[model samples]
Target: MKAFPQQPTYTGFNEPSRVEADVCDLEVEGELPLDLNGTYYRVGPDPQYAPRLGSDIYFNGDGMVSMFRFKNGRVDLKSRYVRTDKFKLEQEAGHALFGAYRNPWSDDPAVQGKNRGTANTNIVFHNGQLLALKEDSPPVAMDPDTLETIGNWDFNGKLSSQTFTAHPKIDPQTGEMVCFGYSATGVDTPDIAYYVVGPTGEIVHEVWIKSPYNCMIHDFGVTRDFVIFPIVPVVSSAERAKAGRPTFGWDGTKDIYLGVMPRRGTARDVRWFRAPNQFASHVMNAFNEGSKVHIDMPRAESNMFPFFPDISGKPFDRERAAARVTRWTLDFNSKGDTFEARQMTSLVGDFPRIDDRYAMESYRHGYLCVSDLTKPYDALRGGSITGMFINCLGHIDLATGKHEEYFVGPTSTLQEPVFIPKSATAAEGEGYLAVLANRHEELRSDLLILDAQRLADGPIATVHLPVRLRQGLHGNWVPATAA
Candidate 1:
């Protein structure tokens, strides 16, 4: 077998590993907690075959699923590739057939009409089934135990939207999941579809809304009564794509649009509020204050993704872009279509995660993965595919404006930290933080289970893996009992 040439972006910490272990008994550096018993599942692009385009971006590879199963004071690691229609077709052909990252117009005619989803962005475990989710298409259902692809699921054919969201929020008050899809009808369209999935895994509600411009709305926020849709300046044009011009880019003239609507309402009820020219890819959480809405997220001055350049062919100076957690408050009582944006803290980082048990409610503390101090900020893909040498994990008190951090040193990097509660009755942040750390200098990975309440104290247990796992997008924690 010929070895695939290493793509420079895929080298270092983003390298793809073909190794799949059924059971891995990792060496623990510290004491493992007895009460922690759940599986931490993550998905990332790990292409099995070399790209036909010679070189590809980090987000263009095929989806690879990894698992860290905890049982009875022991940890077992396993991984497998998601068997998608695209993967099978490529496997049968023995080469790549897909086009550029997301421009289907660049694809070969043979696979043009086929599904373009890699299902590589996020992982979700709902109603006893695991789903590999990408924002471009319907989620591919998989067997959680064996990591085998069941098939493409469209919520029993009731999902009218062509795609689903990578970030879906499960309501704490009601066991319903609120999700939405941008460019839902087709790529480069302003169409958006909002969906609600019941606890039993059925499509409960569906509504169609359109953004003011065709933009990549990757993530949104959900309050008890409302859903917040943030439409930034990063946009796409099918005409530009067909002409071989840039498909996605930043438009400085466009102002940020926040569509605040009732969770059970339609597009006509959506009240659009305009904010400054700020861009945020992810939202932490949102809540209602009667006629007012508060949405919290990390805001950057401009589009941080340099790979997807502006249509003008001008370079985006990533050095000018830095992310800080900010809060945008929209007041309907003011009788206007404007909002107040305020910087929450001086802490700068992405992936602001709160304890899901308190989601949609008044939450207290949250955690974030910060960039490694030793490396240049622009060295890590500007801000596109982060988590490579994001060496620090931070905890913030939402009420007290207090912050604490754990630095893994300059030798290692950490992925986004996911919070798992200790028990049903445990206090907020009285749980464990499951973070996958990559020691790129040593070419190895470790799953660090840190005490959330004692975040500054460092990991309580570290499960070391034999290979360096590529940094991924998002994942979840599924308790043993839930399965």
Candidate 2:
């Protein structure tokens, strides 16, 4: 038996539930839509063994992939480990061979030169295959139906980069997956590889570019005309990794840059627009109106992850870290270096999602998990390991500038909400939201199905789970016809 650390990351609702199960006919509270068919796949960090260093961040755990299959109004769940190289090595040794998160220098000597991907960030289905992603390594392909690990996929031997982004945008019109890999050459390098994968998983186009600085480019934006990469101040360096420090840290001195390049252009055509120091991640949606491009995302004034401390030695400021939905507009006609930014909502939240059908086009209807600090919270039940209590689901109507939220009770928190269109041709925002709610007191989770148009009305159906899933980063829903 292994004993995990008693820290908050390993106790209470955050405690590791290393369970692989196949459950059928889950109890439902309300009527599930007959059209609600397909699978909701989510991947999160669930460490298989206690950390070799006796302590670890929640992001450093092993990859656990969970799939909820819906068929004929019945739901079934199947979960299994991703079986990455790191997972297999540690499983064979019966102990952890990896070290700190993204710090290869700290890994044990025996596991040197091996892939360190956790595949724990997000799971996306592309070209008939499920890709388990960690951003630092190539995608781990899995069977879409069985959820069985296939292997590390390299686009049938075309992807030369060592890394691939966990967040890949699928164009509804062209059916192409637009993705890029930062630090493409190595762990802390500035090289980024941009790829456009066709509908059949073939590499349509690949371009190599250099970032203005080495930073954590977790997510990016893509419109019909251009791809936007926000280079924030979460800086990383080779020296820091060699010194065994955290792979990334907040550098307030660096200015934020949004690199915009034509969808079919080369690296030389890339334009770097500058902005003041701030933190932004997880794009909501991006579209263009002729020469001007708009990107909506959650923006904060400072670092959000406390584990990645400030490089300047400044203590993390919780107030400044509250992220709000903000829209940034960049004009190609203007010669200026700065873009216009406007806060779209007052809700403090991250993990934004929009209807997939209208992606890369002028559209509305966005969903996210909101952390309403004004509401009552049960601290005794404990909050997330990130030290935030996300207790609400927010619906953002960009066209009307209206924000509506549904608060889950004081004893529970919510994960990222994914939008499920009612039908293939449903109007924009005419869909349902699949959100996972963590019941802290019960030590389990419930999947809430809410009408996206009337979010405040609460869940129309709640799918209960017997086991508690660790806080997950992101997930997506695949329609039955597509799956």
Candidate 3:
């Protein structure tokens, strides 16, 4: 009899180890994949943010979330932690990821009462001054450089009582600021709808864009002439029950569509760009029905459950394979609709951020997605492998359908990848992607930097943190100039 060799057993990690990496010294740069020398910081926990009872976890600010301002070689933090108490904190600041506080005056009952939650939101730099949108009070004006509250935008009449999702898009051609609202609060009739505001912060139009579909607006991108919106149709009994509505069925074949319209166009102008069907549900990341418009989604997958399965580990067994990669370009011309698309299951991602650009243009590459396969109704109460993994940034050239893959790590749960350029004054072609890797319940998060240009290149630097970030909604990179 011969003795058999033993195989190495898999030891699950509790957190990613930063010691297993090296740093990139910025002084010697010749197209390095990722700069290892880039500095990392924790802006701190969001006190103003909290999640809804049964909805997916959200970055709501009851006051705890803080804003980290980076400059020269240092990081500065501003937060509501000291201003409000845990018992009186706001649920989620009006803005997602970007911290913009809520207006304390809106009479909407969902945001009223002692539990009337306010939130920290984002500051949009508009017309020399920064405009801060929130979940309460009035829109606060701030100095982008000093982050000082300069003034507030004035509005007449009570603002609509609805959960307004999606960032306001400006009509590059017309200059009108555009925004929309979807009501999940159960206060309004016919459910979801939209609106538009002027640059001075006056409500221009609020209209209902409804369908029998009962869908939520996911991610929306704006162009010179039109606003491109991605709508996800979901049928959740728990959601209806939670919102105090009755459960209804949606036709599975009714495809999702990208709503296209002029920046100031009427509801009639707001028509479906293609057939109401979205390319596929599996490929979308950080999505919600109409409640969440656009996310900083950098990568694509076939199905969310496959990656982050509930405790049961049974794949999206009920739904047949409905995801097929398709290329559809939408033109939201006010006069009519224009779309040029090709259906293909190959190019599987959208909204790629490139070197030193905002999410719209900065498809820099790299995506960190959390997949907890366990069902919300199932075993999470017992704890399990809520799915987590990292896919190397994918390079897509839709013009030619040419694609390339970069450093995809093994079974590690990661967060949104923020691109950090090599220099304090990093121009194009000198940026790197950074991510927070949790490595599947390695409960702590590890800060990692990867070569943006070379995906195959290993980690340039790794920073192990001392705390645990439950799940982050969204975050942005502030270079030294703004720090």
Candidate 4:
């Protein structure tokens, strides 16, 4: 009775796998780490039903959360769909009632005023709650042990903002979560809300500011003293939404603004630094030295998302879209409105991660999913959901300026890599990297564990999964004691 479209977004490795199962004691290719006891939680878009408009982007799918439980010397698997309002409405109707990504006008009339969040972007464990985030709405809290949807959480009704960020940074020292939301009031609004949630999961501080423009603020950075918000030109307008166009589009004419404010300061203390048009997301790490703050992230010359097309009708330039790790420096000591940016690594990739313990501090190591085009790739086997071939995992040493990589086979691509420290007090970069690899030919997936310091040595253990997980956006590792 259900037939998804045959378009590329619904075919190959991108096809929907609406499977929710609990498989105990999954098969492991190598010896599992006895001390590695925790859960790796990840969420990705997996539509529960066909789109009402006959087609939809991959990002608009329902949130499917997968967890791998590690204990003793073995691992188990459990997965479930977050019972979001959009998913519940579609389930009741036996088809999709919602129409497009962030486009409320395309939705069914009966479902007006409903929450349209997919909760498909990222998952994090904090304050004894597992939060599934989508950026467009408040976070959905799930039971960490059972993966059961508890409901939408708004900091015990203390959060007044309508939206929350997916990429929240937890301070290693204070254990506080630093996050922000753009278009906080509504779509096409320049209002941005910044919050600092204490370790007990209460919003201890809040501030509101206006962005230079209404655009996408996918991720941000936080040092001990400051919060950094980089607003690019992937903008939204009410006119575009009313006209039935995409909610957000690339605008190359506008300048990028980097707004920096004290972590505990008010909006009046915020400083806006301007830069030329560019694209950056997913903060790798950020730190400060007195009045100078440095934020590290992948920087691309133009828009990286092909789904959000150029507003000026310019074709997406793949060459300019390739991103490399770059460091942005903002000095409050200087009286200039501009910041300095310098490319740090030649390794072209995104979805960057680092030892979270070194977060908000000067760090030397980082990890990311890499696309090495010079390597062999069998495009006929399967194409990437992002339309780019991401065939490897990379590690960069900022202190030494050395780049190392572990290349997956031609028939495989990778998801974002998460770093797990070997121990609570281990030295920086002395840890294990856990990443999911999509096996195109096999139509399955594998969770790989590699030594972070020796990535070129390849996986030490591979946890095999019978089902292929469609491309996921982000995930994190939760220690057993914390979970």
Q: How many residue pairs clash in each candidate?
A: 0, 0, 79, 0
For all predicted structures, in order, the TM-scores are 0.95, 0.98, 0.58, 0.98
Question: How would you encode candidate 2's per-residue C-alpha lDDT over 78-138 as one tens digit per residue?
Answer: 9999999999999999999999888888889999989999999999988889999999999
| lDDT, candidates in the order shown | 0.83, 0.90, 0.40, 0.90
Q: Tens-digit lDDT track for model 4 on 312-344? A: 999999999999999999896679999889898
Candidate 1 all-Cα RMSD: 2.7
For candidate 1, write residues 51-105 as lDDT tens digits.
6666767787888899888877888888888888788888887878887777888
Off by over 4 Å in 1: 1-5, 372-389
Model 1 per-residue lDDT at 72:
75
- State the lDDT of candidate 3 residue by residue for 222-248, as single tens digits: 543345566544332334433433232
For candidate 1, give the lDDT of residue 287.
Answer: 88
Name the lDDT of candidate 1.
0.83
